[model samples]
Target: MAYPQHTTTGMTTHPDLTEMRERLERTASSSGAIAVEGLILLTGVYTAISPWAVQFSSQTNITVSNLIAGVTTALIGLGLALAPERMFRLAWAIVPLGFWLVVSPWVVTPTHGARPGIVWSNCLAGGVTALLGLIAMGLTVRVARQSPR
Candidate 1:
């Protein structure tokens, strides 16, 4: 598949060909590590804010399973940040997160005291986090495929 037409962009974008060439040269000179670092940073921020500010953590609503998921996210976030170059390939984790973020309102189904705002906000947060993960994942994968290791 002749991709890269739209799906990927490095650290540079230009309106003209000459500027585009220069931007590409600059990005190619120092892109791989920076891209991975950006991805890890995104994961870190997402992990930090999600459980406290984004979750519906009422005593009645919060439970053991959610705690487990939060713990799991912490571990995964650590992995992504520490060894982003290696672990970044395991990017499919974003899919479920994306799914949940997109459908959290329906999934939560708040009956009595519906926190639709919280649900939507958290869902959107998760979706944005997943997007960041995907960007890093795809970029690292592309670079790996293009460059010999």
Candidate 2:
């Protein structure tokens, strides 16, 4: 018996991969998904500038923390918007990031003690970020289950 030899030129295509991409595209293009992505972007922007807006810029530690978190969140939002198929895999990350934002006021600035403004700002921003993350995760699940093989 002779066995067939398989050869590859690094240009192989899989039907399942194509189908999954299509499903992800459809999910990402939905009006609701678009709105969520936009909102997430806005949330990131708000979180970044919140320190100054809330008059908490005096705290160097928290200010830097928020700036970093805000930039990261914004990047995630952009990734999702630009490449949902790939970025959705990271949807779960936003939850933790949000949680960190919420607790950073206490954790990052424990020595100085968090003012009401800082606490309120972080809590609200964190809540919104976490909520949006949940929504993004749901969308990811929906896309995955759309057409199971």
Candidate 3:
């Protein structure tokens, strides 16, 4: 019986697998663009939402925190658009990601604490954003590694 060949990711089957590997590499590169792009976008939305913290939060530092978040998100957005490759490689890229996780629980907290939407809205938005960002970061890393010089 003859063995069937594998065809996927725009590549045909090959004995040496060079063709297949190259196709996969290209496919990954394209995928990386989206992953990186998404992370950047999520980071932006997170930042933009920060300014509106006063609406959901009654905390004194909500304004300050929101400002910082805005700046961070803007920076990420710029970075992603400018040179996603560098942004992806940044050593501290994952630092801000911690915020979404930390903030999520707060959203669920009741108004007795200090904010209206702070406890839940942000939690949901941030959570989704964070997940997308993480996925993008991962894909960026994979694509970066696969890319040829």
Candidate 4:
């Protein structure tokens, strides 16, 4: 029996892989996608600082909660902006994270004693985060459908 000779020293590159990479690059570079990614990053940064900005940092529990959630959201947003091909699949995670932010004020605070500013801040930020998550999901789905199998 004779072994087949390799054409090149390096590993073979699949055509589909190249096409997929190109498609992902196109999707990431699209104007609308860039805008959405930027908005997501801004929202995350706002959320992270909102506890102090809204003057609700006294509530230790809610303060810590917002800090963690906000940081996670910001990191996710950054990841999506920097590597959409790898990060877009995680877009759906933002929806639940946003929902948690919306309800955390009441649940994390004692006796439902969240200040109006805290409530407004969390609700607004959460709503925006959820909406951005939905938009990101749509963009991911659209790109997936457009790419050839």
Model 4 spans with C-alpha error above 4 angstroms: 1-15, 110-112, 147-149
Cα shift from native, residue 64, model 2 (Å): 0.5
lDDT of each: 0.52, 0.89, 0.53, 0.87
lDDT of 3 by residue, 20-86 (tens): 3554345435755556555656655664565464364445454455445545655765666565544
Q: What is the TM-score of each candidate against the true structure?
A: 0.54, 0.89, 0.55, 0.85
Evaluate residue 98 in candidate 3 and report its C-alpha lDDT on the 0 to 100 scale.
42
In model 3, what is the error at residue 97, expressed in angstroms? 3.0
Candidate 4 yields a Cα-based lDDT of 0.87
Q: Worst lDDT window (10 residues) for model 4?
A: 9-18
Predicted structure 1: lDDT:
0.52
Tens digits of lDDT, candidate 1, 1-149: 77565666555454454554444333333556465445545544553455456555552343232344344455555665565545555655654655555555455555654376556655665666567556655655555445322
Write one digit per residue (lDDT tens) for candidate 2, span 95-140.
Answer: 8889999999999988869999999999999999999999999999
Error of 3 at 128 (Å): 2.6
- The weakest ten consecutive residues by lDDT in model 2 span 8-17
Top candidate when judged by TM-score against the true structure: 2
lDDT of 4 at 32: 89
